[model samples]
Every structure is written in C-alpha cells, then in structure tokens.
Target: MLDQSLLSQSRAGLSEIEAEYIASSLLRVCPPVSPQHTNLEVTKLLNEHPELISIAVVEDNKPMGLITRNVFMEGMAKPYHHDLFDRKSCIAFMDKEPLVVDQNMSIQTLSFKVLGSGRKTLNDGFIITDENGDYLGLGNGEDLVRVVSFLQAEKNRLVTESINYASVIQKSFLRSSRESMAAVLQDYFMHWEPRDKVGGDYYFCKKFDDGFFLALIDCTGHGVPGAFMTLIMASFLDHILLEDNRHDPAGALAIMNKKVKTALGQINDSAAEGFDADRFSTKQNGQSDDGMDTAFCWVNTQNSTLTYAGAKTALFYIGDASSDVQLLDPDRKGVGYVDTPMDYQWTNQQLALSKGMCIYLTTDGLIDQIGGLKKIAFGKKRFSGLLQEHYLKPMPEQESIIMQTYYDYQGKQKRRDDVCLMGFRF
Candidate 1:
C-alpha cells in the first residue's frame, strides 16, 4: 500500500520549501514492494498503475533496490521470460545498487551528484529516502532538470532587479549636492560610469562661504563593495566639512584618513608592529586594508586662488597665460590603510585662479583602461596630450571629445574599472 501519511506530509511542506532545497518537491509517492514478492505479483501491480515509471523495493521500510518499468516490461516481452520467472522473487530483476538520495539535499548538491553518478540514473530514476535511510518516495530526473532551470532563471531575474534599484539609489546620492556645484562654477562637466550597474567612483561638491569644495574619489574595489565604500566616505566627508575642516583641503584629507582607518578597524598597533611592506595583506593582518585615493580642492573665488590636496591622486590645470597643461602631484601615501600613520599630514598646493583657466580631476580608471591596437594602458602621457589638445574647447564639447577618444581607443576590449572625470573652467 502507498504511504498516504508520507505523501500528505510532502504536500504540506511544498509551500515552506526554500529555494535551496527545491529538489525535495520532486518526490513522487510510488508504492513499494518487498523483496519476497513474486515477479508475477510485481508485474500485476505495475500493469494496474500505468503511470508508474519505477518502484522501490523495501524491507522493514528501508529501500533495498529499484525496479523500473522499462527494464521489467522489456524482460517480460522476451520469449518464455515471463513463464521462466513467474514465481521467482522480484530481487532477480531489481537493480541492487540504485542511486539513493536524502529528501532534504540541496538542489545544487543533488545536481552534482546526479551528474557524477552514471547516465542510467536519469533513465531509471532514483529513490528518495529520509534522514534515517528509510524509504520516502521516488524522484524523476526530468522533473529535477525542469525545476533547476526554472530556479536559475528566477534567481537571475531577482538579482537584476535588485542591482537596478541599487544603481538608482547611488545616482540619487551623487546628485544630492550638485546644486552647490552649479551655483559656484562658471562652467563644468562630469562623466561617471561603472563597469556594473553600480560603481565606487564618485564626486562631491559643496558651496562654502568662500567659493566651493570639490572632490573626485576612487574607493577600494568595484561594484557593490566599492559602492558601499563611497557611501561611507561621503558620510565621513560631510561630517568633517560641516563640523571640523571647512576651508582647508589638506586638513580635510588628514581627518578623513583617520576616520576611514578607525571605521574599518585598520588602526591596530599589534598588526602594524611586524608589518612587512612587500608581503602585507588584509588576510595576513586580520583587518580590512580598504581605502580611497582622492583629489580634493577648495576653490576660493573671492581670493582668486585654489587650494588643492591629493591622496595617491593628482590634479591637472591649464592656466589662461599658457597653453600647456600642468600637473600638481599628490602626497605619495594613500589614505586609510593599515600601514598609513594615524597622524600623517598632507600638504596643500595653492595656485592662482585666472580667467579662462581650465582644471581637470580624474580617477585612475581612465588611465589604467587597457585597449588600443597594441593593448596597452591609456597611460598618463596619452591623457595629458588629450587634455592639452582639447582644453580650449567648451566644457561640454570637451567632455564629448574626451569620452569619444576613450571609447575609440578601447575598441573590442572590456572595461577594467569604474571611471570618473570632472572638468571646470573659471
């Protein structure tokens, strides 16, 4: 007789099964026969249930082997086969070494096991057992394949929706302070793109009593992790600007460095004592070495001056008096790492702002992108030439030209990192 209690229990748990254990839903309540049953009796039972594909042979509720419909019918159709084995035990035709799986196994793990086990399991099906190795029911390979494909498609749809929502949130945050930038700048243009739906590269602008403060930051990693770091950096930067260092670009950077280190727990003295610069890693030190490279500027329009500071980043500007683009190198050290000293000081480089002066700030993403006929990095030299060639153009036009050049050189190659470039004219 069929185990009606087990069938009812499997049906009850259908709604509660998690995505990981979806394979358990494939259980079919096929009645089992004992090994002592005659072949003629087993054939009578199979003929009565035309829909049955296979049945389990059990002794004391534990599965002993499997008897598939095709194998049984093929043997019975042979000449004198039924007459010879009519009174023989069902064990004569049963596959003693059939694949048996626990009902609670995850779908992914079951798929791997099925693939590794031979192709016969697919044709003959398999037996499902409980945690105690007792017979539960049977499972169909065809049903398993269909369920796996459906689950995979559903997972991809959900993930894509989530990432699309995240991209919207990140964009909203980046634009929150954009009015401040528009109020002070004579002209400006910004280009930001992530290799994925969301990225780590971000820019910030805030209007101060003097002029404005602007920053272009490249945080550690890319995609979701990088996006998370941008939010953290933005929060800390806002707090520092509002409460502590409003007018000093270098002072702001120094404070931000400490804040990042403290937030990530990268300020341990014990970890720093034996630090080997060449072999240092987050795994070895038991701390996240995540940090950001930033180019920060405080433009004092009233004084016609700009104070610029950087952490492993640089600034480029073409003064009205000369056609050449000049570079302002940053401090050699990066911010917010296990190796960076807590009290490290970064100095500011001040330059006079003149009419028609054009300034540019960028993350390493653009320069480090690999492409072109030779498949080399875009490099600093090519970037400088591109800036010098188009510095005289209008800000919007300059942005278009720069982006076009980048894409043209990037032909057939994949983007390596997030890219952000900002240009402004005084």
Candidate 2:
C-alpha cells in the first residue's frame, strides 16, 4: 500500500532535480557573494560558473544582498556586458535584503513567488544552512510542484496495486474446474465462451467405482459473483461424491438444493423476494445462490447403465451409428425460483446404454445465442440437425464444427451471452 509511483525505473533511484532539492540550492545567509570583486571581475566569475543558479553579495559571513545578470544590465549606463562589468564592483550593485533563502523552506513556495513578485523582498525565499549555519543549500519553487505531482501519482499507483492483489485473492478463492481426471471416457472438452472472463457457467466430474459422475452448471450472474457460486457448487459436489460416495444424482440434487436454500436464506417468506432485488443490493438481499442449473448423469460403463437428473437445463444424446439424438428437458422447476409448493419433487431418469451413443450437455447460451444462420440462432431445430449432421465425427471434430458454425454465423452480430457445450462418446 505504500506509494511508490516515484519508483525510478532506471538504475538511478535519485533524479537530478531531487538531488538539487537535497543540496538546498539557493543563495542565502552566507551565499558565495561577489561584493569582494569589481563589476569587471564579475564577468569572469559568471564565465567560470556558467551553470550558476543564483548570485549574491556577502559581508562578514552574512548575506548583504543579491543581483542577477538581468538586473545588473538593466541598471547599467552602457550597453555592453563588459562596460557594466568594468563600471562597478559587485558590492556597488548588491540588490537588497530578503534575497536569500533557507534550506528547510519548500522549493514549491519559492519559484512561483519569485516569478510573480518580480524579484521583490515580499517574494524572497529563506536561506538554508547546515547545523553550523555554513550556507548548506537553497530551495526553488518549481521543484516542489513537481515533487507533489510525483507523490500524488505514486499514491494512485499504490492504490491500484493494492486492489489488484485483493482481486487475485478473491478470484483464487473461487474454485476452477478440476483438471486431474480419471477412468471412463476421457474424450471431453470445454467450449466455454463466457459473457465475461469469469462467468456463471460451470462443469465438474467425479469418478466412482461403479460409475462416473458428470455435470454442467450455470449460475445467475457473470464475472466474480458467478464464479463464487461456481466454487460453492464445486465444493458441495466434491463433498457428495468423494466423502459420501452418494451415487444417486437426484439425491445429490435434493441435498444440494436444501443446502443452497439454507445458505441463501431462501426458505423464509422474508427472503422470498431475494431474486428480484436491485442490482447493487442483490448480494445483500440474498440473491439467488442457486446460480447453477445442472444436468447430471452417472455412467456405469461396465454395466451399460445411465442415471441422469437435471434442473432447469437440457441434455441430449446422439445415437452412435448416425445423426439421431434425444434431448432431455429439465423439469422447468429451477434450482431456485420459489420454495413455494415446497413439495416439488426432482426426478431421475434411467436409460439403457448403447455402444455407439454419444452423450451431450449444454447451457442455454449456445441454443439461445440469437445470431447464427442468417442472423438467427441455431436453435433447437438446427441443434438437433447438427447432431444428425455431425454425429459420425469424433467428439473433437464435432466440437470444431460447432465453433466453425458459430464464427460463420456470428460474422457481424454481437455475442449475446455465455456459451458452453460438452460431449462424451462411448
């Protein structure tokens, strides 16, 4: 959180301006004045210190006054630099008092003051000296302005960095899909085109001695909060599969539904309006934690058996020999809409497995994309057709065809929502 915008990208951590500020660059108290020299000699002195910042006059270790070249020339009787130099000694031209400055004074207060005050005593700066008052340094107005700007910019950068670190932690806390998978058919891929990078779309897998568990879920919102729901679902599903070895898909859903209702406080009448809360207050008003709409199935490849359960989603199966498929429509009762008629029962469907049948699941994003095939979505009709058209291709090629079709259809239309599709073939 420390401000570090002033951090030098170069090897030189200190800048020339900063160094000058540190040097207390100014004429004061006992500035190296030229009262001891004549005006002619002043020219030589100027030539010697061509890089001179300011000139002054000193007497007995104290500042008498100061005069710059401009003032000296304006008061000169002759036009030539040498004439003015020869006409008077530096002491004869000492400007006046209040020309000196102290080291501790801010450079910010000095430079603009000088410019605006036209070299008057009221605008004069303080002289800075060492502990011994030995004329240690001088201050300037411009440097302070620059330093303040640098500090402000540095502060902003630090704030941004702090926010980024916090975001990384929050995102990390939201779980991602498990990649270490085993058993059954490993021929699955994700075509996850999220409306945002982290969206409500989710999929998970679990392997059991008798069958393999698979699911596709989509939450309510997109981005960070959707990802949070995804994480919650992942944790719960993992707990059910690994810890309890609960192979019944409907049983898992019933338990998960209850848990989510409790977690979101949706069981009470007061929280019934949680789903319709304003955008900003959704998190506070207990927005739908039932973000996941899932189609789950446990496959017993050895026994050629399948048990599937779904909620407010759809799944399809394509016969292996050709392009014929079955679409499994969910029981319209979503994960969370209302606990009203709390007796709503979730059903699990059983199917006999065939060697050539391919399994497919998708969120509405794909079918509902709204712009494909002449500005029209490849809706249910076309989706089923694609199954009939590409059913013979390997799962990977089949996926590519869908992507190709998406691009071909979405040439100019804006993408509407998150799209996800998964396929498994026996």
Candidate 3:
C-alpha cells in the first residue's frame, strides 16, 4: 500500500500561476498499491477510502496499471469468487493498459487526451506522472472540464473588449470626416450602418478651395478584416489627395489603383518592375488579392460642375428641373487586383451642377441586402424609386424615410454586409 505522507507532499509542492492551469493542478490524493498486493488487501484499502473512484498500481515509483472500484467489487462479489481470488495478486483484475498523462501538460492538451482515450478513462479517472514517469497522483475528468469552460469564457471576454474598443476608434475617424463635409456643403445627410460593431465600408470627404472631394469605398470583406482594409485605404487616399490631383477624379483613381496594388503587394511581375517578389509574398506564398470598389466625386463649386469617376461603383443624381433620377455608371472593373492592368485609366464624366440638385453615393451593401417577401436584393430600381419619391424632402427627412424603408423590407432576414450612403444637395 502507498504512504499517506507522499500524497500530502505532492499537494504542498503545487503552485499555480494566474496565466494558465496545468495538469498538476487537477491531481487528487489517491494512494497507489503494489501489483503484488492481494485482492483482499485492495478491498480493505477501498473500504477505508470510500472517496477514491480508482487506484493506481505502481512498482519502484513508476505506474504499472489501474484497478477501478466498481470492477474490483463486482468480481469479488461473485459466487465462489472470494475463495478463488481473495488471496491472489490484484494484477489478475487490474487493467494492464491505462491512460497516463504528464503532470506538466497544459489543461487544454489534457482535455484532448482525456477525450481521445475513451469513456473508461473519464469514468475511472487517469494516472498523473512526473517528468521521469514516476507516479504523482490521479486526475478527475470533471475538474478538467470545468477549467476548460472557464478558460474559453475568459478568452471570449477579452476578444469582445478589444473589438468594442476598435469600434470607438472607427466611429471617431468617421465623425471627423463628416465634420469636414459639413463645413462645405449647404445640406447633406449620411446613413452609415455596419453589419458588425466595426466594418469595411467607409466614406471620406475633404474640403478643397474649388468645392470638395467626396468618396464612398467598399473594401474587401466585412467585420474585422474589412475594418482593417478601410484604415489602409484611408491612409492611401489621404496621401493621394495631398498631391495636385484633388480636382481630378479620374487621375486620383488611377493613382489610387497603383497605390493599393503596391500597398497590398498584389502587383504582378509585368505591372511592377524591380519589385521585391520574395519580400512582398504573403504567408501562403502568394500575394493578397484584396482591393476596394469606390465612387469618387470632385465637386467644383466655382465652376458649377461635378467630375465623377468610379471603379465598379456608380453615382445617382436628381436635377431640380426634372423628376427623373439619372445614373452615371462606372467602369466595368474594380481597383487593385492582379487582373486589372497597372496602366488602366478611368474616364471622368463631368456634369453641370444646378441649384437644389441632389447627388447620392452608396456602397453595394445597401443594394445587395437580401429581404422582402420574395427574398430578393433591394436592387437599384427600388433605390432609384425611393430617391425620386423623396428627393424634394429635407436631407434629414429623406435619410429617415430611406432607412425605415430599408428596415421594413429587410424584415427578419440577416444583414448581408456593411451599408453606407451619402447625399448632398447643391
């Protein structure tokens, strides 16, 4: 039989860190018995310690096997069983192959091992050993489960806190941009809704001496990955606008395309000569193909004209003289992919601005949202109809009506993506 003092020594030696819990922390004081011990001797030990579900069999301080309480008692209770095996060695009834784990193993790793070792190990418990394979004690599967659950909840709490902080930063950036627009425009309204706490869709506005530069960008993906892309895109746009291309919408777009390709390392050998191929390659041994679709407008208040340019995006305008809503379609290609040419040039569509003419720009998220009785996209037709119907209303009222209509149509369907819409009346 095992010494009771050894169990006390093992428990006194353990010290846990706040960082993580290891296998040793799950150890319980279950004394081991030699395999040469008789069944009658094992039975007496069990009777003395009713709390132990199983006992380890060790020889020379190294674990040999295990004998569970239920299995041993069932065999000993059979007719003529006591006479045949009461004096025999406990090895006759001990499990030869038992689940044994290192005391230093992480709780996460121990959980996996216990699950894979089958139900018997979980029910009867398992042996815990030191580094040199010496028997330490036994571990309960129930304790392991509780620790795993607590760790998972703590991890989720930290992740949620970080994401919420990111949302605050993103909103602050957007609010600053909106203030810049408000300084120049006579009347304007913006409806920005992220499918998550933070998203990839963003709008930018910068006041210029001529009038102002405005853009609505839909970056690749949504949520955290997409939100990261928006920051990258914003940095590039700020750098590009600092140049002389503030009044040139098409020229700004061309420079933006090249910059995005370079920033994301999406450039091919033919597009970027002397580029570091090995240095720019992603972890997957390939370049990131991520890019954004954008609608850019350079409004010249002095010239009474608006120069519009887009890459896989469009602009809508309703003139004060007409009830019809006009659409200025964009180029058929997107910006900053391996497929788009490095020298690709977008054309500018200049339109004469009029008093009380309302111009609108939006990301695809608003149109692609799936809902309504037929479970169809909100679509351009429905969007144009809403604009035409409510173009004469005040900017704030128009925003409210448009958002309410969108929500009513959406109903119980899940939001598909980040949505951003901007409108201004000149």
Candidate 4:
C-alpha cells in the first residue's frame, strides 16, 4: 500500500470548483489484468503497448489495484528479479492503496486526494469507478487539470451573461422620473442598492391628484430570484393601483397581499403555511415564501400631513429642530404569508407635518446589515442616530452622508442584503 499522507493534507481548504463531477473526462477502460495473471504475462502485455503508463488489476468487474510501467521496469531491472518473480502473480507488486476515484467525484476533489497521498506526484495515475464500484478507466493528473479548467471557464461565461442580462432587467423597473417625484414631494432622495448585479430590494414612486405614493420594499431572496420577484411586485403594484384607482397606503397593501397569494397559488395553502411553492412546483404553482416586506407612505402637501402603512417595515421621522426622532412600527406580518387571512387588515397611520421635518422609509436591509467589531447587525438604534444626526442637511446632502456612513460602518464586510432608503421633507 502507498503512503496516502500527502492526500490528506491536500484535502484541506479545497476551493468550491473542486466540487464538480468528473463525467466530462471519463475515459473508456478495458482488458484489465486479473490478480492471477503471471508477472511474465503482465510484462508481455505492458511491453506490447509501451505508451500505456498503467494498467488496472480487477476481479469480477471490481478494481483491485493499479500497476505502473515504472514499477514493473524497475523490478525487472533488479539482478535476477524477472527470473525469480516473472512467473509469480503481478498482484504481489500491485499498488493496493492506489488513488481510486468515483466517476462522479469532482476533479478538484480528486486532485486533492491524489496530491495529499504521500506520493511525490500522481505519476502512477489512478482508477475511476462507477457508483457500484465497477472499474471504469485510468485517468492522469494532467488530463484532469485540462478538463476542469475548460469546464470552469465555460461555467463562468454563462454566469456572467446571465448576471449582465439581469442587471438590465432590474434597472428597467426604476422608471419613475425625477420631475414626477419632485412634483409631489419637493425635496426627497431615494437610494436603491442591490447586493449583487441585481437585487431583491426596490423603490416605487408615483404621483396622483391627492398626493404621492412612495415605498421601499425588500423581497424574499437576492440575486436573480429576488430580481425576478421585484419585477413581479412592480407589475402587480401598478396593476392594483390602476384597477380601482386606489391611492390609500393600507388599501394598496391589502390588494398587493391578496394578489401575491393568488399569483403563487397560496390562497388555498393554509395547511402548508409558509411552504415554498417554488421548490415544489417551479412551472405553475408560483412562489411560496415569496413575498415582500414594504413601507408605503402617502404625502399631501395641501394638508401638510403624512399617512403611512407597512407590512413588516417601518418609518423614521424627525419633526422640526427640537422634536426627537420617532419610529413608526409596522404590523408583525409581511405580505403573502400562506396562512394570512384574506380579510387581514393593515393600519394607516397619519402624522401632522411641521416645516423642515424629515420622513424616512426603508427596507430591513439597512438595519439588518452585518458588521461592526463584533460582526453584529447595524441595528435600528444606530440607524436612528444616523438620521437624527444628518436630517438637518439638504435631502441630497443627507443621502450622501448616509451612504458614506453606512459604507464606513460596513468596512470590508460583505454586503448582507439589498438596501433601499427613501427620505423626504415637508
């Protein structure tokens, strides 16, 4: 048996690419030497094919071990080695502990196993087997490297194309014009940042005769799936608003919740509450656990009032120079929970506005970001302090300060989720 100590060391800290299967490079193998094959018979077979570096020793279709050309030649070169051993079975010198890999094993993983083996290199080659442990073929370290490199390049290209397309689609949803938003709330800023090229977070702004509708929403997941949900949400919200000309924040939310449930076929899913429909039925069953947490606000400068409603989202408010920052909490439930009552209600909270007062609406992404020395959440307390400290600045300046502060706090940490923040002053 070969010392496999090097293989054990190489297995540590292997990268993700090593997790891929070896099916692409699988080679056909045949004419394995039996354990009973005499060394003279094996030598003659090897000599006939000088190019064959190794041969498998198998019994009943199961691989027993491997024999390399170098070992055979070295043994034969020994004084009287062939005459003394040629008639003996080749199994006496076969590598019983040779590197063996399942056909489905990833090439990276196989490399780790081979390199970690106490051998200086995998020059002896290795054996591949089917799931049932039937001998498949012999593979070289060099060939494995070539195939894996090609596969990884192909995988990277496909992913890049998909992400670029998704980025385009996500940008299209941010269609609200600055003029339209300014017509409703004279001074406001909306910041939308996705954790990836595309994200699960989005902001919506629309103006009607009574006032303007503004919202920040965080969907269930991030990346492509989350981006898809954001598209669905934007479409549905627009359709709901136009259907009955509903402008009230709470009523709009109720419509959105019902529509999301119906779209996902979760209207009848009380028994499997919260079950992810997408996991079970990707084609037509729609999404389960696919809902948004949102903060919706209506501002009417005519009456100097702000009305807001939320589904698992909140609002931060600071009125005038002397008023303390305030948090307007949302209901505990988000939109589209499977068990949510069709008749469920949302609360519409109203507040009187003073000159130079600021209102903030955000998805949980901001407060939930992981960072700090302890790697804890940024939290609502710190968020509130940020707003309170900078609310006095112009809306545009405030946006810059907030973003810079958030990035400072985040430091080198990976972004945790999509973030959306909207601020306005009356």
Candidate 4 lDDT, tens digit per residue, 1-426? 222443344345545555544643545454689988999998899989865778899999899988877777778879998889999999977888777778888654464455345231245578888899988888754344334323433344333344664576467557663456767767889888888888889888888777777778898788766775676677667656654434478888888887666555455543133333333332344435558899877777678787889898988999896557898889878887666666788999998888888888877778888887888888999888888888888898988988888898888998889888888887
Per-residue C-alpha lDDT of model 1 across residues 1-426, encoded as one tens digit per residue: 123343233233222224445455668888999988999999999999987878899999999999988788878879998889989999888999898988887664465355445345655678999899999998865455434433433333332334554466578678755777778876889899987888889899988777888999999887765765676677677657755375788899999897776555466543222222222223445456778999889888799998999998899999987879899999987888767888999989999999999999999999999999899999888998988998888998999998899999898999999999999999
State in Å the error of residue 408, model 2.
2.0
Off by over 4 Å in 1: 1-161, 269-284
Cα TM-score per model: 0.60, 0.55, 0.61, 0.58
Best by TM-score: 3
In model 3, which residue pairs have backbone atoms overlapping below 3 Å?
none
Q: What is the lDDT of residue 209 in candidate 1?
A: 78
List the candidate 4 regions with Cα displacement exceeding 4 Å: 1-160, 177-179, 243-245, 269-287, 321-323
Candidate 3 regions with alpha-carbon error over 4 angstroms: 1-161, 270-285
Per-residue lDDT of 170-261 in model 2, one digit per residue for the tens?
A: 24432233442334576655676667655667777665676678788887665545544564565556545643435577777776675455
Score candidate 2 by TM-score against the native: 0.55
Measured with C-alpha atoms, the lDDT of residue 305 in candidate 3 is 95
- lDDT, residue 288, model 3: 62
Whole-model lDDT per candidate:
0.76, 0.57, 0.78, 0.71
